[model samples]
Target: MIRITDNEFDKLASYIQANYGIFLKKEKQALVTGRLQAELVQNGFKNFSEYFEYILADTSGSAVTAMINKITTNHTFFMRESEHFDFFQSEVLPFLHSTVRNNDLRIWSAGCSSGEEPYTLAMILDEYFGNEKGTWDTKVLATDISTKVLDTAKSGIYSNDKVGTMPTHFRAKYFRRMDEKSSVIHDKIRNEVIFGKFNLMEERFPFKKKFHVIFCRNVMIYFDEKTKTELVNKFYDFLEPGGYLFIGHSESLNRETTRFSYVKPALYRKK
Candidate 1:
């Protein structure tokens, strides 16, 4: 493995924090080394310094994209944190359906990893709206920083075990068996989610419409206290009044610092 120097580590860590809002501490150096060792070896780079320059000088942005992909972990499965989905189906959906005059149910699956969360939400939306689904704009916007994961998400394919934990009825209705080992999400659910590469650190979000719900679960754990506060505020701004935010259960907001009202564990409201 190509060893990283203290100075080289500092430079790379600063760059990641500034550009991606991902805070890497000194203790995580081993993690950085482990994740990025293959990239350096594959490219014939002798050290982190060379790799850093390679990323900085690449104007097409693929180099840095690849760097982030290696350093970030994207572990997720369908119906993760099941209670949030239950709340969405039982309370949020019914409220939005009745109150949203435009019949446009805007939902976002921010930091959606490998497509499971957004696809799961799409299935729920399909089941909830049923016959009236055609009349409503129920599209879900799913975004992630890694292009590799975005590509996987866009393909809408998954191993059978990945979708296996889901309830039997959902597994039967939403997935089409391609082989014994894998299944593909039916186009009905796949089409409802629009996948894109997005970096949450961007100063401004590009959307014109505020969302009715934002599911940014487990993504903020990488950020520091300041970064998390800023990102949470950004979420608050992009959501409509009475909108709901679902975060990782392990994460909590400082009630003193945040504008969002506490609703339950890992859930908040924009009112």
Candidate 2:
């Protein structure tokens, strides 16, 4: 494997942090080297610095996309964090059903990787609304920074092991066995999710309407405190009053500094 020099690593790390809000520490050098080694060889680069320079000059920006797909960790599986979904089904959906004035419901799965999270949400919404689903708008906007993952997410296919953790009923109802080892989301459920490529580092949000619920779980673990704080605050603004934000269990927000009300671990509500 081609070794990444300290200078080259620093430059690449800084670029990723600045553009993606991901904090790549010194300890991650081995990870960077491993993930990028193939790309370096495939692109005919003799050294990390040369590859870095090529990335900076690639006007098509596909190089950046490819780099990010390797750099960003996208290891999510169906219902990986089950508690959030439980809370959503038991508490959030009930509240929305009772209080939301119009039939329009908006939920966002930011950094939705490989389709699992958003697909899970879509299934929950389908169950919650049941026959009333036709009366309400219940689609979710799923976005991620990696085009590669977005493509996978759009296809909504998962290996059996990946889908194994899903609840029995959810698996039975929403997914169709594509083969011996893979399952694909049902068309009706799949249609409820719209996937897009989005970078969290963008200063301004472009949404015309605020979300009723935002599932940004596990996505911010890669971000530094400053980046996470800024991004959380942006989430606050984009959420409807009383809207809920579900983050990863490992993450936290300082209640003293933010407008969101702490509902539980990894869960908050815009007050």
Candidate 3:
């Protein structure tokens, strides 16, 4: 078993928090060991402290991104919570379609790891609006701190196993089989999504345009209460009024922030 001393854990946790806003707990020491052992060995580091030193020396190191990707649990799928999509279709889209002057609909999949979440959103939009022909100006911006996952997401290819949650009709309609084991997202759907590397801990977003829907699910669970509040507020600022914020089913903004009002169990609207 890989060993993680208290000092090593603290160093790593601090580094991750500073760089990615992910607060690794003491219990996660073992998890860190399990996930980064091979990386340490590959990088010729004898122990966790040495790896920590390497990270401190170069915060932009790929090791840090790899570590973040390993530690951050990305348990998401196409329409993981069906109700959110139902609400999006039944309520959010119609309202936006009517009130918004342009044909453009902006969506931000904030922690969209390996592309499933945003691609799933793209498929839904195409299916619901019949805009797959590229006649409409719709786009989904998918961002993640991990360059590894962002690269995978940009590739827009997934093993059949990773796409198990996708509906049969959607799979047939929006994806083409790339090979025996993987499928490629159709160009119309793939082009609708733009993937980027983003650290949510950043003080400000550089974009002039705000988003209509922000899907930041399963990400805030890694942040502390203060960080959660700050991030939620940032999300609120990044959204247009009445825009929707979809978080993980297990997460809530009850005590996090007042910038958004809870619309459903895990859905919130900017106020």
Best by TM-score: 1
Candidate rank order under lDDT: 1, 2, 3
User: How many pairs of residues in model 3 come into backbone collision?
Assistant: 0
Q: Show the colliding residue pairs in model 1.
A: none
Per-model root-mean-square deviation over C-alphas: 0.8, 1.0, 2.0
Worst 10 residues of 3 by lDDT: 129-138
Give all TM-scores, in the order shown: 0.98, 0.98, 0.92
Which lDDT tens digits does candidate 1 get at residues 174-246?
Answer: 8999999999998988999999999999999999999999999999999999999999999999999999999
Error of 1 at 87 (Å): 0.3
Query: After best superposition, candidate 3 residue 147: deviation in angstroms?
Result: 1.6
lDDT of 2: 0.92
Q: Model 1 compared with the native: what TM-score?
A: 0.98
- Candidate 1 stretches with Cα past 4 Å from truth are none
Best by lDDT: 1
Clash counts for the predictions, in order: 0, 0, 0
Question: For candidate 1, what is the lDDT?
Answer: 0.94
Task: Sort the predicted structures by TM-score, highest score first.
Answer: 1, 2, 3
